[model samples]
Target: MSAQPESVTTPARSWFDSEDAPGRRDLETCIHCGLCLTACPTYRELKIEPDSPRGRLYLMRGLNEGRIAPSDPLVEHLDNCLGCRACETVCPAGVPYGRLLEETRGQLDRRRATRETPMRALGRWTLRHVVPRRERMHVIADLLRLGQWSPIAALMRSDWARRLLPPFAIQGFAMTPPLEPRDARSLERVAPRLPAGARMEATEAALVFLPAGTAKTRVWFFTSCVMEVMFPRVNHEAVRLLVLAGCRVEVPRAQTCCGALHAHAGLRREARVLARTNVAAFADAGYDFVVHDSAGCGATLRECGHLLDDGPDAERAARFAAITRDLSQVLAAVGLPDAPASLRSPRDPSRPLRVAYHDPCHLAHGQGVRAEPRALLRRLPGADVVDLANADWCCGSAGVYNLTHPVMADAQLEKKLDTVERAAPDVVVASNPGCLLHMRRGAAARGLDVRMAHIAEVLGEAYPAPEMARAPAR
Candidate 1:
């Protein structure tokens, strides 16, 4: 890791030249109140000034003022940040730390001239090329599924064999849920099982579900790429729950990845490209809201307004941003039916289902959706909900933070799991795919006898199909 070239000719304008780069105002807005320190995960874990929000702002300011170049040390400090946006929730100064950090990263990316490290190059290739395209992701998922059934599955789980694999690959394998076949991933395949005679129409453009009764509202469900591939059951449950809540649901097939990962990784141009594609995907949806089950995807979808402000389709981006809502928010807003009798605890009908809610950082800090999910959960028949200590803390699942910064991620994860164990809830609910996957792997690795589900899945349990309702408990 070398310092940025000091002797190189300065650019004609400011060193931060990219459109994605933050202006002086954003940097100046950080009043250095130190209010964000307690809320910052990295600062708490490392107890270092450089890892704190204020310190990072100082580095950004120094670079902006030409007092320091983008040294490897500076870059390392920036990269360590989780981008969880927890600081924003408590910042009295309203400093856009997440945006500033991203913009600064984008600036460095634009200025860099050295070749990328092989691992970085590979990561970029997958993020840019594979993850965004559904067909490519499916092909990769199919391959992974094949590996899971083959001898490679043993190799992946073997401690000795894991030592032979790249760290990222091992981390990736650990995070991935067992893959299901393509047919099993389709929402159409489960249409027959949707509650209450709901009618569903599927096409390459979108999947539309008409409620059994008159629709109170209509929304387009923003299915995330990773969620679609790795956690289709969550998506399916989300649709069924939405339809049951008196809303017609449409899932636009043309919609692509929300580009949260790209933007977080400083691929600004690529993120903007995906934003434009999504704007067009739901161009004619004409729905009340654009709903997403994954907190990360919803937060990123809402960012289109800022990410594509300079593009020609800025209005479309604005439209997309305006309607984007997390699944909990939408459900809370639209209201849900009274919990059915069957929704009570299976072990003892006299007691409520013991559920602990893990607030995904993006939903809690990004979308300000702390209460919606809990409110929905409490409404479940005989639901005994418990508060997770530091529920709003990042579960070390800030997008790919667990994979890239595993050590810090594990440290935060240890704290979170400790809290989970203390609560001893039957099920832990998370709204983001990353958090669900990361926490699920952690819980399983420790051999904790607890079930992990997306908020949608937990809520969906209350609205099982008629046939399922009659079936005796196993």
Candidate 2:
């Protein structure tokens, strides 16, 4: 990110010198188009240009040309952006807004390296230290899970607790779904997890799964770090569904976190390290595709080409990115073997399972994956995929955006929940973890009966996973 050993010549007057810096030509392509205005969640909420993609591009261009200097207001304006990439989706000129913004952030982080706010400092530490380490992340999750049921959780829920710690901390605690047991959440337990007729064989370094019949294709399952700890049920379902579709599913043992959170937070150095690790982990694994269920992680994995677009690893990164696909994309291509047929509305057996699918911004906007998920949802034996107003619109759960910019996050969340309530579906499904957790919290706070779930969970309902080995009773 520092561009210390760069190969390209830096512009004489430019403030950004990194190889990854926002390219001048990329900024000039914006055309000052307002087409992205309504699509932008922050601009829609604040009605300001600096907060919009066009305005931000102008600011980036100004800095790249040395027309302006780094300042607090500039960082605030850039920081307000959710980086959901909705702007890119609507831009006719095809401006890579997310990439440019990330590069610009890297430049600013260097300038303000010594001036991190308490909140920002904490975020940087967590992204750098905790997220990339599998064991540490699991430990933290286990602790949080314990706290969720303790008397302290009730105390934290009280109004007076806001005075003791950051409001975001309390809000995040309230938003977390109940954590699965640590024993059940382990990768060893999760990878071998299968449905009723499926079987698996464990090699020294990986687990190979065989479907109920002959395997159709080979896939390397990337179990996202957060998904495993927070939503292991969904991970199990993803593998179960994959095997059921007649694929030889392999779970690589050496893979690390996808680094989407790091890259989004502008910790590019850490992001690059994690990216290279993954590229090496799956090298020569012999798979038709590297598939994952979490949309955000899928976007990051696919963008490894750009994240590592320098040094000797560039070509390999490109190769890795090429084969990476979201869970829905692979399933859509391979097709589901059968729909469970028992997944119907509880209130009326004759009615199809009333469902609404909310598109995660990363899936819809980041990876250009919109239809695949919906198509899979439609294939459910009794499903009626309802029309969600602005289904592609972000649910204000843009990674850690809910914690970093809670006010704006809530503004967008309220509007999203409003639409969900209007649709009045029995359940709402999203592919990414953050959106599911955030929207689930909002639905519960409002006492809405609507259940928020991952697409895999709903898919699992249609095609259930294998029975689990029961944990001993206390």
Candidate 3:
């Protein structure tokens, strides 16, 4: 008889085994093609092979094969990644880098022996308690608004403010006045259904618009925590525009924050709680679809269904996820409003304002929505929409990244600023709030006349308001 094949013993589990436990099909698909390396911001900055997507995959492989320990420097390289998901868009092998990194990070957090600390505790508390509660967040936002006009505002304006204050605080001043909260009756009265024979609403499922503070669209507005406390006009604009497109609008007061920040920061348990709360809040509304204007929130809600583990709630969670859509995607489906004849100009006419569009990572890379916003910008009168190099790159405001990894965050922001300066755009248009804040600070740091506005705000200016419907678009 031929000699029996040698028996092979399975290796003991390492810290990285948890990542493999979920199956590495996405990770194993990577062929080290180097395409993602070119797209990675961290790799571009460090020029270190180990920091690139391929490098990270190699390290993960080594750890799995028992060639490297979890405590190796390789772990630091993985931890340094912003989880921006930019690499995901460019990957030819279709690797799920974001999911892999998230799993890896989860493993890291669990394996670490460190006990609870004040900062970590504080972060958990704020994310769990403050962010999900609209009333509490509104109170804090009002306080910040008050501080903006107070003597403390002067302190906030100091050069050291950006360094000393939390990243959220640095960005909080951009919140505009809250929108007037409307009950369902008022929303129905203000934004009635369109006349018969208008563009047929998609019969697949009723599109539930969660207006994240823009009044442009007439669709059902969620009036989320931040939008209600801060950028109210955005939801108003969104509602107005939706109504213009012949959508049935509902302003549901029961809706709250989407819990994206909490989920991204490893507070998955808290995120699930918020998800359940939101699902219950909107459960009996009988809407066919759910939509969000904020890409960050929309993405979170879209994926929240997956976070529910083995329970009766999982089916309901999946149902909620099924209906979620980004506002841009919804608008793109509805088609753009007809640009008024007077608004059409042969050249930039209103002023010599050069506007640059920064594609928020959540909207562009995370959700693959790069064109609709740009198309909307192109229709604006006298708006010079210049495309900066690496326009789709993340601003390093990966949710709370600026707060937790300020140095790397600043480095990424500086690179972004350099690109913006080269393009010399007077105004920066970004889709997500995190990017807007980060870009605002970068511009302020350089004393550049580059103001930032949401895409909806910019579009709202191009369209005439309800009372001014007969007026020509500016």
Candidate 4:
């Protein structure tokens, strides 16, 4: 036989044994226009072609076509992605970059099931076991909360102690919100009071909450696992706002984590399991919409269809994804009662409370939510709503990306905090729990003297209920 070309000398052996492998259509959709380069956080940070979305697409295509084998360098390039999906927003060809990336990671994860590093193994285990379990997460939070109150927290804050700790450890410690007591964290305290003669079938169950007045919209509230423990008040305020908006909201007992963190970490089966659980939980709830306050959870909920497309719940998942709405989207659509006279800067009632809005990456790029949050903030009476520069940029809390890749995460965070300082708002609102945690810590480390809040908290401030303001504090 004549000498074969070098390209044809070896057989192309497939390595992606996972069913969710990134396919040709999504990979080939990238035009290599490089528009996504500037939009991607890693590419912008590294200024490297491989770290860019287009370059990553090429790598994914190579893996899919069996032209390249998974190696440490190749996996590192893929692992470095924040998975913020900012590239999807700017893509002209409408490549499903987020979906493709998740699927590609799924393939890699399956291949490395046996050869995983200790750190990666620990992360995967936690996502599989703990994150999907609400009670265990809260218990861990309680332990961490105890640590936060102990002298250890103060010691950790010291320059010497900080220097001793790894950057990720310090960052993780900084991101920990003051955990709430179970009582304060409970959604039961604020479940709406239904009127004398009115009741709904969904509210007949243990997890459902009712609105005081006529229900304008029926919704199932997805209390995110992270939001439940780290920022419970956001959930409370959000549920309160939903009630006040005439939403008969139900907190389903069966609903679990949205699986964004799981998917980002490449636990595809775990993500699907959680997706299936949610789809099943909300199936008979009879809600007009599935409302979520956390942007990360909201994005994951909106993608449940794609996540479960190959599974038995494919049709149900598609139906579930259709009704998912962000809290801001729902609030804007329904219109809140006027911001009360009490909603003003504590420093001086004469001056408007300056509020700045930071866009959460998943909400903006993942779900295309930008204007609604700004508009909702602007509508607050006596508040000066300000715009954040490059608001839609990822805040580097990309599903634990800050913990895994602290260097790039801190770089992105510094830039974000710089913008907040320039804006100098009394409060900067980011609608995702992860963004709230990450940026809040970043702002404090910079000594920026700013408050980080969820949009629900800001709006809840405006429309205070008897439940939130309870007797002593106010």
Candidate 2 global TM-score: 0.93
lDDT of 1: 0.85
- Expressed as tens digits, the lDDT of each residue in 1-474 for candidate 3 is 776554444564544644223245665788888999889988988899988988988776665555667664766687678878889998988887765665565555555522455666787788878988876876776666577675777787677997887655555453232224334213232233232232222323232433233334344455556555555556656665665555555555666677777666655556677888777766643655565777777767777676664556787778877777666666776666674422322134555456788888877777778888787777666666788899988888777678667788889898888998899776677877677767776777788766677776666656655543454212
lDDT for predicted candidate 2 compared with the true structure: 0.85
Backbone Cα, N, C clashes tallied per candidate: 1, 1, 28, 0
User: How well is each residue in 25-88 modelled by candidate 1, as lDDT tens digits?
Assistant: 9899988889889899999999999999999999988877667777788888998999999999
Residue 206 C-alpha lDDT in model 2: 85
Candidate 3 local Cα displacement, residue 199, angstroms = 19
Ranking by lDDT: 2, 1, 4, 3
Query: In candidate 4, which residue ranges exceed 4 Å CA deviation?
Result: 1-13, 113-115, 158-166, 192-205, 466-474
TM-score (C-alpha, index-matched) for candidate 1: 0.93
Compute each candidate's TM-score over C-alphas.
0.93, 0.93, 0.78, 0.93
> Which scores higher on TM-score, 2 or 3?
2
Model 3 / residue 206 / CA error / Å: 16
Residue 461 shift from truth in candidate 2, angstroms: 0.9
The CA-based lDDT of model 4 is what? 0.82
Itemize residue pairs with steric clashes in candidate 2.
Answer: 195-466
Cα displacement (angstroms), candidate 1, residue 91, comes to: 0.3
- Runs in model 2 lying further than 4 Å from the true structure: 1-12, 113-115, 187-197, 348-350, 466-474
Worst 10 residues of 2 by lDDT: 465-474
